[model samples]
Target: MNAESRDRLRVTVARSFDHVVMAMTLRGVTYLGEQRAPYNEEYDGNDLVAASHLIAWRGSEPVGVLRLRWFADFAKVERAAVLPTFRRHGVMRALMQEALRYSARRGYRQVLGHAQLNRVAYWRSHGFRVRPGRPSFMFSDYEYVEIEHPLERPANAITMDSDPLAIIRPDGDWDRPGPFDRSLRRAPRKQRRPEELA
Candidate 1:
């Protein structure tokens, strides 16, 4: 990947069902097609709940994806995959950086991921360290090790003190007013009288 190609990469939160499917398609290509992971195991039920998906696009084509599952104290990064053609173009790095950035903005203290044993070095290269005292485990027929990255809370991190509108903004888009915020521009609806209803 040349510098110009790298400049063309854009990572964003998957904001709609279509965007979510695009992310999943990238994962399916890499995990199910390349690695032959079983359908059920790859598309576990957690995707639609307490999770956010990030999709990386090379210009107009979706090239990579990562999923973040929120927990009380931390966010877990999972199902990271990049198309084979885009493997050397730093798409995974972009996804991981965006995931960490989003997590920090949400005021999470740590981000966790399970790295396949062979890919431990790859995760370590991105500032994640193998969690000490955690034993190796196997899942989906592969050896895995727990890894975590510590995040410093940003000065503008979201909290109870944030504006209610900002708190309700879409994931990874806290800085902008959402559709619900825009709706506030309209006059409040008036209620009908009891006789009018009858």
Candidate 2:
């Protein structure tokens, strides 16, 4: 894609339900359902925040996605995907680079991810290191190895709470709790009785 089209590719925070559907569908097709929770679980915006769902849109249609989870010292990257038509054209790499740059800008000490066994070399080429230990998660039949990228400075972390390109802060304790937590705490608003409604 050209710079203009690439620049037009908007990455925005999305609701967890949409994200979950996308994630589950993509993972299921790729045989990574073992890594996913059941799809019937309800979710809310806060759940999306905790997961840091960044939906890549080409105009109005979402074509790619990536999720981020930030902690006090580090950020975790996961569930990255790009639609078939968008693959091999640097969409996934662009999303990752943006996420890494964002993490570095947010003051996170590092950015970490669990790469599928088949993608270990791909991650290695991007400067990630495999942690020497057993896998903590599984994607399809493959195990995932922890990989991390250390940041040189806290100032390099991405700050998503601001304008124009505003994003949900991965860190907890913003104006509101993140999407994932919201999902956990969400309760249906009670409807008013007829008398109360009147």
- Specify the highest-lDDT model's number: 1
- 103-140 per-residue lDDT for model 1 (tens digits): 99999999999999999998999999999999999989
- Stretches of candidate 2 above 4 Å error? 1-3, 6-10, 13-46, 133-140, 154-198
Per-residue alpha-carbon lDDT of model 2 for 39-69, expressed as tens digits?
A: 4332323344545666676665677877788
TM-score of each: 0.89, 0.59
Q: Which stretches of candidate 1 lie over 4 Å from their true place?
A: 1-7, 189-198
Alpha-carbon local distance difference test for all models: 0.92, 0.64
- Give per-residue lDDT, candidate 1, residue 14: 94
Candidate 1 has an lDDT of 0.92
Specify the poorest-scoring 10-residue window by lDDT in model 2. Answer: 164-173
Give the CA lDDT, 0 to 100, for residue 137 in model 1. 96
